[model samples]
Target: MVTLRLIAMAALSFLAASGAHATEVKCKGNEAMLTRYLGMFDEVFNGRKLDRIAEYTSEDFQPHDSAPGTPKGHEAIRLLVTNMAKSFPKRKLTNDLIICGGDMVVAYQTVEGINDGPLFGGIPATGKSFNFNWIDICRFKYGKVVERWGAGDALGMMTQMGFKLTPPSAEAK
Candidate 1:
């Protein structure tokens, strides 16, 4: 009886040690909110499946940094995606890091692509490649993104594509 008890205890200890290595512990909030937030980028943006935007965003999605008069709701994202595809046919958005607190999540992203077409209302294609960083802060409600604030290194990207900067003359000032 003493030998059998010793064997059982050793076996249980071995199983417990192995399970620790295989298990990843995440808080309940992380399991749900983080997954949904990451999915917005993974499935909608990086995946280039614009149709999935609705699944990750609310019907009244708001882009705080968009240009004046940009459309509301998912159509705005669709338009942006369409234009970007036209300019950078192989563009990709990658998330370098993401942080979540309460209902807001911030993502650090990198946008990379080769410019094989025109951009900025028909500026000629330079056939140059650009790699720049962008950041996004999203507000979620009921597991779907309702609003976002983001900015990208537009000037850096343009310079990488061979655009020159000229200072304004005194007369213009």
Candidate 2:
């Protein structure tokens, strides 16, 4: 009787452990997808591979940025990417950190490049390389990136490019 009870308890413990492990595996898989998705930005941006964006993003993916009148959707994203490539012929996006869980991920990145060509923002090429940090939060559904909310230092970037905005005289004092 003692031996039988011990066997039953051991079996129950094994089942519990397996269940926990399975949950962990699922979580890790989601995290991997998030990381891979974030890494693809570097690949697509630097390599000028617009198609890769479709491979990772959903057909109805939405991207929100700090800029007003910014583009959205897959085609818009493609245009944005192409324009970025045109602006910064030597652009490079480096992912600094990625945190993900379940179906959400946040990526912190630093983009460094020289705007030596015309871009959508109409900022002429200063031929000067600048580094700016950005944070993007992406939501995933059905194994595809569905939406993203991004915010970055656009003003800082403009300032770095030698675009000066005179402060209001009242505030200047």
Candidate 3:
């Protein structure tokens, strides 16, 4: 019995020293709030209501993504959307699924569009179309999206656009 108690104490002390602890994120709010928030997200992103972006996003919004500039702030987000509209005028940010918890929302998105103008890194339009999947996570505060992170199927889209990942020959190089 003494040995068992000593082992348990030692283990607890080691755990405390190592600082290996798990954090549980609990939503202080309700799921309906998240649903409505996601609805607003989709509406602003897809409905071409750039002017209403202020309503859905906080003034100091921070947006992180694979986009070239890693857009941050409200105006940056607006610019990012405007640039996408230029590339694929008919592009749609279709939300396939949304999960909410702990002041955050994760959205599974299917963005379908055609490359009618420059798409990425000043690359000219290939006039091709693609459907890419994205997983976006947003942190909300006061019912506004304050921070966001998103990852999209960029490689797949580039492949569909006929972008070869092959290395050029010595002569081409």
Candidate number achieving the greatest TM-score relative to the actual structure: 1
lDDT score of residue 150 within candidate 3: 79
**Which should have the higher lDDT, number 2 or number 3?**
3
Score each candidate by Cα lDDT.
0.77, 0.68, 0.72
Question: Which order, best to worst by TM-score?
Answer: 1, 3, 2
List, residue by residue over 1-173, the lDDT tens digit for candidate 2.
75675466456445543543221122355666765675556556557788788777788887776366656667766876777777778765655677777778877766666668875658567875566788878888766678878777878777767778777995677
TM-score of 3: 0.74
Candidate 3: worst-modelled 10 consecutive residues by lDDT: 19-28
| Candidate 1: tens digits of C-alpha lDDT, residues 1-173 | 75675466456445443544232223356657778877877777767688898998899999888999998799988887778878888776766677777788887776766789888788888887667789888889999989989899999988877788877784477
Task: Mark the regions of model 2 whose C-alpha exceeds 4 Å error after superposition.
Answer: 1-29, 66-72, 167-173
Q: Which prediction has the highest lDDT against the true structure?
A: 1
Error of 1 at 136 (Å): 1.0
Candidates sorted by lDDT, descending order? 1, 3, 2
lDDT of 3 by residue, 20-48 (tens): 63423233456665765656666677776
Cα RMSD, model 1: 15.9
Would you give me the overall lDDT of model 1? Answer: 0.77
